[model samples]
Target chain A: MGSNNSLAVRCRSLVKSYGSGDAKVTALRGVDLDVREGELLMVVGPSGCGKTTLISIIGAILSQDSGECIVLGHDLQRMNETERATLRGGQIGFVFQMFNLLPSLSAVENVAIPLLINGTPQKMAESRAREAIEAVGLGSRPNVLPSELSGGQQQRVAIARALVHDPKLIVCDEPTSNLDHDTGVAVMDVLRGAGKKHDRALIVVTHDPRIFQFADRIAHMDDGKIIEVTNGASAL
Target chain B: MLRVAVKMLMGDRAKYAGLVFGIAFTSFLVTFAASYFTGFMTRGFALISENPTVDVWVMDPAVRSVEKTTNMAASALDRVRSIEGVRSAVPMALGTAEVRFANGQFQSFQVIGVDDATLAGVPPPKDGVVPAALRTPDSVIADPGGTSGKLQTPLRPADQWPGGGPRLDVPTRSLTVGDELLVNDHHVTVVGKSEALPRFPPRPLLYTTYSNASRILLPERRRMTFVLVSAAPGVAASDLAALIEARTGLRARTSDDFKADTVSWFLENSEDVGDIAAMLTLAMSVGFGVTGIMLYMFTTENLRQYAVFKAMGASSRMLLAMIFVQVALSALLGTGLGLGLCAIASQFAVEAEYPFRMMWFTPLVSSVMVVIVSVVAAAISARPVLTLDPAIVFTGR
Candidate 1:
């Protein structure tokens, strides 16, 4: 553990459920995890293992039935809709399983959405988004929409969008599931560079083991709970 | 954000174009209905519209419209002229009579009598010198052919007539300046033809000097239908009208009040007005239904994109603003297109001699309705967006 950096997320006894009564299914039972700034954490699990539910709660996109969950220093369940939305726009970034780039917008415009949502001026937002796209080495294809880009390129654009505003924490769900092994490694390399920054942390949830080498720590989850976490070097 | 909203809308060209079409059609219906009502209302007051120079019309108090007025004593015209603010008041007469044509067809005609000296209410002749020809004692002027034919035909079906009515063969030309016709068993000459404002049931028109009308019809004690008045310089017509009412003990109304009174009277007395109003109601309902349904469908189809926006940290307020922007742009473009259609239809109405009068308020009312359409549509479509959970973007469902 790096003792110098501050804690980015603090969780205790986090429990979330779906539906009710006979139809109820528990997605997260009781969980505790601490992610420090400047670390890349990977969560690996089988299907229906609640990895996405955990990150959704962390991203403030969902409300847990009961929890002592805090993200970016705010309790996920206590904040009102507006406050949580503000926190989501200004402090957190999210990447989902599929490359959910807005098909209507060009790559640069899609990348600029987070900054624009944060009330950044369009000109500056686009400039910063271009820089983020360039960081991913897809600078030449910024003007085409997601449909025109390859699967790997679209994920890069999604990553560019997530980091375009320099968010403090990024919660990524299945960042490389759709890519081939080589393309997945390439995308993870770009993501590793983006998340290894000194001031931000990334929590990526995926079943793809090829990217385990890029993480500083690997979290193993099963049956609605975290079963193990190990240093990446030790796991190798 | 607005740019994204626009881009998203453009992404679905079929829905986008469909929404615009729905809005434009609604706008056209609303605007055209208002204009159509305005056209018919003005037609009800066609007498005043055709004689715009008359500032006031003086008649008996029971007169609801100029066309349906009770005759007053000729002395009422003298009393009107004697009022202080009355610039000029001239006696006028109105009558309906039957004239025998050369084809043995006896067509009915609406006759208007103007002052012999001033021709105060006579429109310019369509075929011959009007006031000059009207000065001859036996002369009368008929309307141009279309109105003349319509008016000459009795409104009821021919089989319903007491005598099964007159047979119409080849339609005869309108009474030109040289035609002779027998009226009330006396021969009268058609000295001129004049263009008059058209009325429903198209009345055949005749214009003659007061003396000619007085001798042509059966003798009656009262010879005047209305005392047409003009305001003196710097005097408001209403002020002159009040003064004339006080002096003459006759009702005097400014042109605007008279026109409104005529329209209201038509509404009360005629079923045709009710039919027009029903049509207007139907038009608005159709517009409302179409716009609401189309906009709601658009929102439903784009629900996933909105969820994606919400997942990307777009607030509910932001999502609503985006929808409002889309609706506002649609309303503006649709209203413009609808008004353009109205303008084109107006041109066609003019060519067809349809009694249509377009005023500023017609378009103004339609634009207001369009705004209501946009807001109501937006409000309805916004509920789905507001309820959309941003988490749906991640569930991969």
Candidate 2:
């Protein structure tokens, strides 16, 4: 972890809920957390425990109903949709559980999306995307479509996509949930190796306890609130 | 992003093909219907089209179209000739007559009588035969359209027929020069064939001199149907037409105006026009319905990918543009394919002499309709995508 003064995310009593009236359900309940820069923070919980909701608010894709949730020093509540979108496109990145690579695009093209979103020229974006794919050990098959790649390879491409723009924060939701044990660890090795930069913070939401050793810090949750925060392999 | 959008659209080959097929089918049917309608309107004024030399036609005030005319008096020609813009005016007698073929079969024909002096309203003869050939005693010119079917006569005499009687199985041939027929019991000879334009409701036609026509048909008090006029130098055809109408109290119209009037009359009075219009409406409706549904389904199926894009920080405007680009591509490709098919079909239609004409505006109109379809499809498909919450990407929903 980085110095105590260098905080990448700071949340104080954050609350979030879904639906209205009788159908209403709270997903996050007054959660307080701090993530330092250059840290791999793994959020572990049972199903419907609000692990996804906490990260969603931190990722700037969802808003908290109350309290402060600051990501990279900008209060998400104070930002409008366009400003939040700009922040997400420029400073933050996402990795989905499904390895949501656009099935039609080649591996390199999928990795190029973030840079393209930031208005990078096509040639420059694609060249940088090829380097990113190469870092993820997919340089030889950059032109292969996601459908033609193995599950682990596809997830590596997804990781490459998340890191292509060199965003300050990367939020991954169940990044290895669909892979076998060996492939899951391999994908995590690639993700951790490529994602942990000096200026970047990675928050991974996962149900898998097998990869707990890979985290620098682990936050355990039950229901809608975090119960405990433990250091790295000590959580095991 | 545009490249990504295109790849996403064409990635689903089946849906893309379906979308194209739907649009293409609509374009083809709509274009074909409009072209057929145009061809019919053109043929409605076939007579006015054939007499390109005549600038105006003066007929009875009640005459609304060339196809249905009320005969004018003989003095109508002289009255039109005396008009200020008139250069020359001649009488034309038009009537339906029953003609008995040499095979003893009788068929109805639209007989046209041109002025004996100038043969003013006669179409040029085919096979290099001159208009003066009609000056032969009892001579008339046949239309090529008529000789092919309605004016055909048996190749041999009745004795050569099976069972010693006129047989349907016997070979029949088209009427050529020197063929004789009985018109109202008077003998007439086919002097030559004329390259006449095909009529709307096709009828066999014969062109004869006014004197010869008068001799063959039963005498009527008003034998002149129309007065064909030429505009004098420095005079416009429209000016001559208006002047003739004012002085003679007749319906005097420039050839182009007469064609427009004929088309307007058909539009107002013809059931065929209504039928074609209904078919065109049905085709457009089917196109809208099918293409819209297919596009919506395709968008819905790929919505997950869109959600991912949104999660990746693509704005609503960007997603909307992507959908429009997909639909526009489909519209362009489908419209091209449809029009190409129509063009090929039109060739066969022309060869078979079907009422089909693809004017310059036909394909343009079809393309415009396709654009409208594409826009509608895009708008409908974009609704859900624009409203989607990017947070769904985390929910695994």
RMSD of each: 4.4, 2.9
Backbone Cα, N, C clashes tallied per candidate? 0, 0
Q: What are the Cα lDDT values of the candidates?
A: 0.81, 0.86
- What global local distance difference test value does model 2 have? 0.86
TM-score between model 1 and native: 0.87
Question: What is the C-alpha lDDT profile of model 1 across B248-334, one tens digit per residue?
Answer: 789999999999899888888878888888889898898978888887777777887788778778899899999998888888887
Q: Interface Cα RMSD for all candidates?
A: 1.6, 1.3
Query: Residue B378 in model 1: shift from native, Å?
Result: 2.3
True contacts kept of 1: 0.58
Q: Write the per-residue lDDT of candidate 1 for residues A192-231, one digit (tens) a residue.
A: 7877754678899988888888888888889889989897
Least well predicted 10-residue stretch by lDDT in candidate 1 chain B:
B153-162
Model 2 stretches with alpha carbons more than 4 Å out: A3-5, B21-25, B144-148, B159-170, B212-221
Q: Give the per-residue Cα lDDT of candidate 2 at A122.
A: 92
Candidate 1 pairs with clashing backbones: none
